[model samples]
Target: MVGGGFAGLWAVRALKSAPVRITLVDRGNHHLFQPLLYQVATAGLSAPDIAAPLRQILRRQKNVVVRMATVSTIDADAKTLELDCDGGNETLAFDYLLLATGATHAYFGNERWAAHAPGLKTLDDALDLRRKLLLAFERAESETDPDARDAWLSFGIIGGGPTGVELAGTLAEIARHTLQGEFRNIDPSRARVRLIEAGPRVLASFPEDLSEKARKQLERLGVEVSTGTPVKDITADGYRLGETFVPAKTIVWAAGVSASPLGECLGVPLDKAGRVPVEPDLTVPGHPDIFVAGDLATLKQANGKPVPGVAPAAKQMGKHVAKAIRARLKGVGIAPFRYRDFGNLATIGRMAAVVDLGAWKFSGIVAWWFWLLAHLFFLIGFRNRSVVLLNWSVAYWTHQRAARIILGGDDTRC
Candidate 1:
């Protein structure tokens, strides 16, 4: 493992029962719960609540060894992996290499704004966003100038995917209901949340009716949803979408993603998005000893459409790769990896969500309840799930966010 995202974690879990000696290497020590990363940014949850130490999680597993290191390059010809550690460079040889290294937020050709508007993919990013959001409110409350106050209160979100939509909705709820009575001079309720989507509709992957319903739910929460609008530029003050300039102090980018550079390091054939092109068995072409899974690999189905880069898909790929490795080691014929779609769910706000399960489609409070339960159930540990549930229950009843403290950092240093 070269990454510690959902894919890498699942890959390790699936390979636990195998007889292979697994050495999992990642930059971070903990495996983060990415779906609820928005909650961390919106101050509904803390870092430790959604992250488990990698060492702690696999401590008792005899076949697994967790190393906190960054992979610099892979000598595929020599079958050696080069890693950078605290002390010095280290190399390890692998009979079967599995690349679960995942994707990262793409800046859409403008990498400069990454410093100003950070995307939430890791625990550190979430904490930074939380700090920026809460600090904006605190600064806005004390600002006497109307224009500056408005700029401070304005929040801009790019993209209309599930992550972007959920963040926009939760932020709206926080500003309107949670912090309504907290501020003295500033009405946090008046804070602007503008969601920018270049596509024709939000949640384009979901059903058209469900997308419309999500849009309505966002509007009800006071979020300004702008579809078919492309953000041309971003600055310290805000972003420029063609002729219009939206002045927002806090900007969240959830637009696009690109696969890790590990694939390039291996010199494998990659798709347009820089993902490794894998066979139906999830093995790299010409290298049956090496397997690629999760976001790092692009596998096309019989219908010619590429597999979706969702958590469930990544988990399924991880397990399939592990099984294939085991089968190959036993000298048995391996089955081709097949992805099973497990439906999609996206929450707009409190008591508002949309779930599509092929034959069955649900919306409104029931969908929201299901979404909450499903997320809670997927959380790694019992203690984490219990704490998250307790926190959510308190927030639901009291309309207050518990982790709204703002640490210091300007837009330039984000």
Candidate 2:
């Protein structure tokens, strides 16, 4: 198995009962609960709360061997993978190939923007953002000039998707509540959070009404939502949306996403987004034994829409791949992969969220609780769920985020 995101992890988990021995290779040592990554960025939870050691998660399963390495090359003809394993290059052979390397945030032709605005995909990105955001407030507190202080207090978030919306809401809460009365010179409640989206509305994936509702919820929390505004440029100062220049010290890019470049090394035709084209059974074209799942594989559904790059879809792909592998071992053909639409949820602010479950759509406190329960149920480890619940419960009641410490970053500067 190549890669260790949700697709790879779930694939390995399902194959434990199969007759095959598994080797799960990944660069990281933990399986991160990606859905709750925004909480880690906003200081609502710690990193460990949303991540579990891979070794511990698979300790009971004796059939799985976890390797920490980066796959450098894939020779399809030889069915061998070259990896930078154990501080040296090693060639690992596999009978069947499963590529679940996943994807990274797309800068949309502006790769340099990554330095100015980091996207939240991994734990390191979250920590870097957390440090920048918290340091913004600290820097603002120490600034002598009002203009510079205001610039330090300002934040710009590019993208109005779930990740962007959640970030804007939580940052607003931190400014309006978490940091209130904490600084003498600066009123944290006055901090400005601007969410800029190139689209016509926020949460474009949801219904129009829910999108408007989410917009209102964000506005209620003091986040300035600017829709149909495309970012022209980004620098250390801030971003430019069309003709307007917005000054901000912190910026987050949650806009576009592209598949991992590992798909390129496979010597196969890929889509514009760098995703490997897959067959109905989630296998690469002309390579039945070589399966690709999750965000790395692009598969169009029967409805003519592409499979959404959510956690559920990735897990479904993983399970389907596992089934196909097991069927091959038993000399039976597996059916084509089918994705079940399980609805979508995006939190707005305190006790506010929007949920779209086909026709049974809802928003507000009920949706917020629903979102909480669903995430808790989907979290990988028991300890993670427990700690996250405890942290959220305390934050909900006290309006105080417990994980607000800024550690291991450059000192606060204006």
Candidate 3:
């Protein structure tokens, strides 16, 4: 098993009582709840509230061994993996391999833009963004020049996806409500937060009406929503939208993502997004012993639409893979993989969200609460869920984010 994300973790857990021994290898020591990662990027939640150590999680399962290593190369024919760890390089052999590696940000051929506009994917990325965000306000407070101050205060998020929308909304609230009267030099409420999207509408995957409603909700939170405008270039000072260059000190990239490079190590033909096209049973074309899941694997559903790279879909795939493996061991034919459709949910701001459950669709305060409950229910550990709920309760009543401290950055001139 590779990666400690939802797919790999779920697969390992499902095989707990099986006859086979499991070795889960990952670079990170913890399993992160990625859905609420935006809250950590913003100041709403701490790192510990969403992440739990892998070793502690599987302590009771005696059949599994966890290895902290990075997979550098995979020799599929030999069924061996070259791994790099802190101690030294090593090669591990496996009877059956499952690559559940996730994805990272795609700069759309503009790799240089990453330096100026960072995308959130990991705990380090979130912490770096939080530092940058908090320092922007601090720098604005201390600046004397009006133009420079305005530049420091300006924030741009390039994308209208769930992460971009959530960041924009939470940022607007931080400026308009959370940081009210905190700084004497400048009013935090006056900070400019813009959500830039090249597409025709925000949340394009949702219903047109829900997309419009999400746009309105963002606007109500004081976010400057700009659609149908493509960014030409991004620099340290600002970003160019169409013909105009907008000065902003902080920029976030949430436009696109590409799968982990490990897929290429398999020497298989990949889709345009660098994802491995797996068989109906979630196995490699010629190698039935090898399986792929999560963001790394791509498959078309019965409706001809590609299965989404969401948490639920990954969990389902992991569970299915376990079942398939057990059947194969017993010399029984396993059924083809089938994805169950669950509704989509995207929260815009406080008391605002949208949910699409096929026949049933709704938006606003009720959706927001539903979103909250669903996330809480999906969170892995009880301590994490309780702490997150408590933090959320405090923030809800006070309108003040608790984890607002800036740490570990050398430069403060964000």
Candidate 4:
């Protein structure tokens, strides 16, 4: 198993009672709850609240061994993997290989923009962003020049996806409510928060009406939502919003993502996004012993639409691959994999969200509550759920975020 994410972890857990021995390898030591990652980036929750150590999680299972290393090379014909660790490089042999390696941010050919606008994908990214955000306010408070101070107070989020929406909404709340009356020279409520999307509407994957509702909800939170506005260039000073250059100190890139380059190592033709077009059974073409799941694999449903890369789909794919492996050991053929659409949910701001469950669709405070509960239920471990629930409760009632401390040594110069 390659990756400690939802796909790899679920696959490992599902194979606990099986006859085969397993080795789970990943570079990161902890399994992160990515859906709530934005909360950590926005100071709503701490890092540990959404992450669990891998060894601790798999301690009870005796059939599995966890290795902390990066898989550098995969020789499919020899069924050997080259692992790079702190000590040295080593080759490990495997009977069956599962590549659940996840994805990273895509700059869409403007790699230099990454230095100015960072994307939130991991714990480090979140912490760095939190520091940048808090320091932006602090820098603004101490600035002497009016235009420089305004630029320091300005913030821009470049994507309209779930992460972008959640970040923009929470940042607005922090400026207006959390940091209220904290600084004498500047009113934090006057900070400018902008959400820019090149597309025609936000949450393009959702129903049209829900997208409209989400836009309105963001606007109500004082977020300047700009749609159909493509970003031409991004620099330390600001970004080019279509034809005009907007000055902003902090910029977040949540626009696009590409699959891990490990897919190319498999020697298979990949899609435009660098994702492997897997077989119906979630196996790589011409290599039944090799499986790919999560954001790394791409599969089209009967309806001709690609399967969404949400947590549910990744978990299901992981379990399906595990089932296939078990059947293969018994010389029994399993049926083709089928994805069950479980609907979608996106939160805009406080007491605002949109839910689409096929025939049933809803938005507003009720949807927000539903979103909260659903995330709590899906979070791993009792302690995590408890801590997150408590933090959220405190923030909801007090309108103040709990984990607002900026620790990293990030550049906050205006």
The C-alpha stretches of model 4 lying farther than 4 A from their native spots are: 410-414
TM-score of each: 0.97, 0.98, 0.99, 0.99
Q: For model 4, how big is the CA root-mean-square deviation? A: 1.1
lDDT of 4 by residue, 340-379 (tens): 9889999987899999999989999999999999999999
Candidate 2: where is the Cα deviation over 4 Å?
412-414
RMSD (CA, Å), each prediction: 1.8, 1.0, 1.0, 1.1
lDDT of 3 by residue, 141-168 (tens): 9999999999999999999989999999
Each model's total of backbone clashes = 0, 0, 0, 0
Give one digit per residue, the lDDT tens place, for model 2 in 153-230: 999999999999999999999999888888999999999999989999999999999999999999999999999879
Comparing candidate 1 with candidate 4, which one achieves the higher TM-score? 4
Give the worst 10-residue stretch by lDDT in candidate 1: 405-414
Error of 3 at 20 (Å): 0.8
- lDDT of all predictions: 0.88, 0.92, 0.94, 0.94
